[model samples]
Target: MQISRTTLAVLVVWLAAVAAWLVVAKPDMKTVQILAGEMAPATMSADGELPQRPPADADWRPLDQRVLAGWRDPYWLRWRSTAPAVQGGADRALRFSLRGASRLYWNGRPLAGNGIVGRTVAEERPGRLDIVRVLPPSAGAGTDELVVLASSQHQGLRLLSADAFAVVAPAELLYGQAMLPWLIAAFATGALAAAYLYFLAVQRGRRRRPGARLLLALCAVGLALPMVEGWRALVGYAYPWHGPRLFVLLGLHMAAAMLLPAYLARHFGLSVPMGVRIAYPATLVAVAAFMPGFDARSAAVLLLSLLASAGLLLRVQGAQEERGPILALVLAGALAMAVAHSAFLDGPYFLLLAILMGFLLLRHAAHLRALDRHNAKLREERAQLSLQLLQRGIHPHWLMNTLTCLQELIEQAPPRASRLVESLAEQFDRLRDSSTRQSVSLEDELALCRSHLDIVGLASDHPLSLQVEADDTRLSLPPGILHAQIENALTHAGTGACAQHPFRLRVRRDNDRWTLELRSARGSAPHRGRGTGTRYIEASLATAYPDGWRFVQGVDGADWCGRIELTCAS
Candidate 1:
């Protein structure tokens, strides 16, 4: 499938985020070679020295786990593990990452200490958490000895381990470890910013879709994942917090696993079965619990969530257009997780979430735009229907009044009846011609009004006449707008009253506006509120101008007047 603009835009955002990370973190690519599986417990040491060997009674524990505990003062930790055979003349080093001040030794040969190890906080000088010592060529392929004189007297938090002490391939390897956290943190920061923008977009839209809730939830997890992944770099916590950190990280991943499917369900407007809701997270937890390591567990949870969402989407009926993009994204996420299984949580996982959330935001924006357009079209159609209804209303009332006048005149004066019939026929012809048009020139509207008045004059004893003083007659307005006003004036103002004062129409130009005023004498009849004529006038004005038009009609001194203001054409 072709990539959408939104998806491409999302990709651009993700790339920008990655670029920002690279600029800030400047990470090294070199990899560290962990030496052994375990290290002996640390014991208090008075003098900083390379031990002949680890004590016989020392308790051995896994290197990757808590290797030192219950100690507040200075101590020595030792490790003896087979080193990878160094190629002749190849550069190699010992990498140490520790929380406190430390001095180190390799194979009984003294090396530069990270910082001074002291018995008390007053004398303790904290060291760089990560340091490297180049290994001598004579250091053979057999078992290598490593000893660290470590002190935590300067540290405020009680840590369980002294961090990692391992045989690194080169100096760059130590730099990589030091920079990894920052790199992850930078990526997380960018993703976090993107998520915040996505949330703002959700808030700014006119129509908030159900998918918005899911997009927000995705953003929430997008927020948490980076924090969990880059916590070490962002916070600089001691080693003691590592276990709790992992627990929290794992907990977040589990929550995300549960949330992703729900998010997808909400996003696509699909109703998820209760079985899957219960089974999916349960399966995620079950699989994650058996994973070999925290990274594997995290990856498993994310990958499974994506696959499950894909499966759910597959069953969605009649929504192929909606289903395709999200399906592709979830599948891509699953594939990315599978490929980056080992380091998914480190940085790749954050990148994946950014891409997914970005695409969702883009799609949501597109959906909202489409919704707005649809609503606008609906409003336009409804306005057109109303205008048509008003247009249709005028014919019946005008025809009925003319026929009544013709019948009366036929009996009273046959010659006058013939003239009224001719005027009626001419008015009908004008109406038929203007019926198909949305708007007509003011000149044509005046002709129709004159014809209408001729019929009224021939039929009534007190005939009505129209007087027009227009600055320009070519100005366009909705068909029959002024004609309806005249009819209303003759009906409510009374033909007898109009016969005395005469009906007046004056059109003038002022700046960018054209003002038309209709003046007539009001009859001594009870005041009637706005009627069908006023509605027609307003609806026609709205349909014609949509904006920049005004209508007002009420008593003005001795006469009844109606005013229409139309914006001039640019």
Candidate 2:
């Protein structure tokens, strides 16, 4: 029951999302409905004083279900509170909407007002549509009398008023209203920020691509949409500027429209069409500019449809990586959201961010996979290097002979013993360096090979000589292959420890191939047993030049011949 790092991270993210949802949605708080009826006007008096009771013959009507359902005009409402105002303390506030110009009163006391009410379009003034008024704690609770005077008059409007609204706990009302969008916005912002930095950190590495930077930008800007809206909800949509949120929403939406097609085009390696690249956002601007006859949301949706269509085309074009699939899913989600609204996904942030974060996670998964492969390859190469280093001790089978020869040299000939010691030290050093590198220069390899032959000559009665006939050029090849061949020749050639048989090494290159030939005077056939030398050489060749090398291990007509032919990779 060990959880992978990815799963653990996902779980932690889920927990955070849930916690944020709880805080944003305020699920535990109860909403007490403070008002739920149509409004009536107070009795008028000559002294400009309002009466406490409504006149019997006053023109009062319950907000018609049809009218309230399709409300789009100014409305005045008077509600008698059923409970004390600000029952949960001044920390609570009233939450409702009154479009155009409006004023509110509590028990004949002026509470708040936005803009000026007018009877005609020319006289009308713009005001805040959403309101949240925290009760002054100094004013004792139990005040229930509430009145709202809303006026909306414009050339495009016909109705005088629409309907009275409701009163609920500010926390409960705003939270419940905006919970889903806030959840999506918060998660998207967090995820995209992390993913953006990940790509930025690894652009020099082999994982993240350059085009993904556009996706990061898309997510970053898309995150702002729901955030702007959700913050408006959190603060009861209270703002001094008129229609600022509306303009902000349009600008962000239009930016997404522009960014979406661009990201999709770059990711799938296609050209963004002229229409989507130019006309899509252009239409949004036209609509917002013209104002009266144009439906901005509809225009925006059409532009978004262009984005979705581009994504679909990318999917059809065989761009089926994480980028393609993720783009398709997001575009499809956006379409579903447009048609189904909150039914498909609750929030705008989640709808747009779903694909962005999905793509980010896919990139993370790819990065993890690449890193694992890199680690595994490093481990395997290190193992092979250690093996090659270990092969140096294989001549220990004649260890007694070498030691006996060294003892004689030390006692009878001090000069030869010193030369042997130096050769042995140089051999170990060469082997150490060769083991650590995949390839070494021909000159260096030849030096190490001669050191091995000299060391072997000390223990054997036979003298060893080296002959290299390359065309005065230096080349690099995988180390230890030729060394391994030399070791094999010495091991199985059956040259007597005290016999005077000489060995010669020759190297020459053809037009495209390198040839290394080792000959033994005894001319023993190659060992057929499953030995380490043969396997190591074959593995190294396959790894370095899988399709361009040949290794033949057998005896020539008169000598034990082991030769390797290698062609450098193009």
Candidate 3:
């Protein structure tokens, strides 16, 4: 039930089609004609009579006169009457056709036919007149007269026959030409709004909040205003309106103007300044003042404020590190709307605004999809890096050292060394099996720790103890992330020193975290400079877990120790 950007775009196109139909499809002359009265040539000569001619040598010229004066220019016949005639009938129809263009007058009223004069016609010569009509019995026959005011600026003549009049009703003329299209558009827009609201409600149910829903609701409201206005124009309900309807329409327009900047800023990942929040309410008040008097100055001020807000949004959008495509979409939409607003009413500018807004909405949706994809890719890479780090940490060096010590102890004392070799081999096998995995069980890591302790104990003459307290349940941790701390302790512990020295290794797990502490007598301090082992460990932690792992090392007088804490994988 969602009204996606694509759906809105299609709706916009549909509205455009409706507008085109209204502008391009000529209305039926029979339906629009107001009266069907004949005017003799002599009768037209008198004032207050039908088909009256222009004043002798009158030189009133059409605006943009050059456009019609080109080759094969069409001409119009003009006439005037003494007073405006009111034609009355159940169906006031006056139907007629001409070659190019013609004007009409009733009782000295100049029905200019300005709408048709500027139109171009193909396959026609100059001085020809086309057929046109004005609808309903708005002009009547009591002491009233009718006239046809025609002209051919290119041909420099203004005379035509009286056979061109036809009577028609306004309601019937507009029924097919204007009102129908407007009705369809109104229904479509209503459908779109209902679907959009349904989508917002569903999202609210899932997200358990109304903020996103309210934002979308505001967007729907913005789109609805233009849709309704366009419908009104199509239906011929725009002029001579009731007071309340006009006020509501103006208020809705103001709401749309205020909502647009906020919508664009949020969509493009730009910040909306606090100043805008304060200024928008003030704009609302100014827009409300447009009632009863319709102040053009206040409207101008509101427009200027909107432009300023859009400029502020552009400034913030320019400074963003990402979201370039989204920003570009919003900027392009704003520019298109600006150009459209400045053009004439007949230029279909409102339709252009709809198109641009639809594009911006599409861009916003695409940006969100792209962000989700990027986050998924990051997660995959992290898993891969964690596995690689585990493999590197539990390498062949530790096993080789344990085997060499076992070989030496085999000759000196066979029984204890034999038991130590078995423990070392078991641990090496465990490490080999787990090195390729992303996470190893805490029990497995503890077993490896035990093997390491055996090797260190056998290699040293002094007393060395290793203890591990962890639940047997398989808690997962990256390989070698824990072992590095144990190795650092051994390297600094003076394994070849006098017999009185002692060393200890302890590992414990509590809840979701694992901690390892190693202590030894410092016969000589190891190089204080950074080592490859430490650097590798740190780098791996940074890539795999970021802030999830920590390592600390310190020397207390003659005692050297290291501690590592890591969050276990689920």
CA RMSD of all predictions: 15.3, 13.7, 17.9
Q: In model 3, what lDDT does residue 422 have?
A: 77
Model 1 residue 492 lDDT score: 77
Best by lDDT: 1
Stretches off by above 4 angstroms in model 1 are 1-34, 41-76, 80-94, 97-103, 106-144, 149-165, 176-192, 195-199, 202-205, 233-235, 282-293, 318-322, 335-342, 386-570
lDDT of 1 by residue, 447-561 (tens): 9889888877776767888898887776888777788777777777777778898888898987778999988886555653276666767766765664468999878888788
The better-scoring model by TM-score among 1 and 3 is: 1
CA lDDT of every candidate: 0.68, 0.58, 0.48
Q: How far off is residue 287 in model 1, in Å?
A: 5.8
> Model 2, 229-254: lDDT tens per residue?
56555554322232455566656656
| Deviation (Å) of 174 in candidate 1 | 3.0
Q: Which rank order by TM-score, best down to worst? A: 1, 2, 3
Per candidate, the number of residue pairs that clash is 0, 0, 39
- Model 1: lDDT of residue 498: 80
Clashes, model 2: 0
List ranges where model 3 is wrong by over 4 Å. Answer: 1-90, 93-140, 143-169, 180-218, 226-255, 267-273, 286-306, 313-353, 372-380, 393-570
lDDT of 3 at 382: 52
lDDT of 3 by residue, 372-449 (tens): 455456546555544554554445776576667777778888987877867666765866775566566666765676
What TM-score against the true fold does each predicted structure earn?
Answer: 0.52, 0.44, 0.40
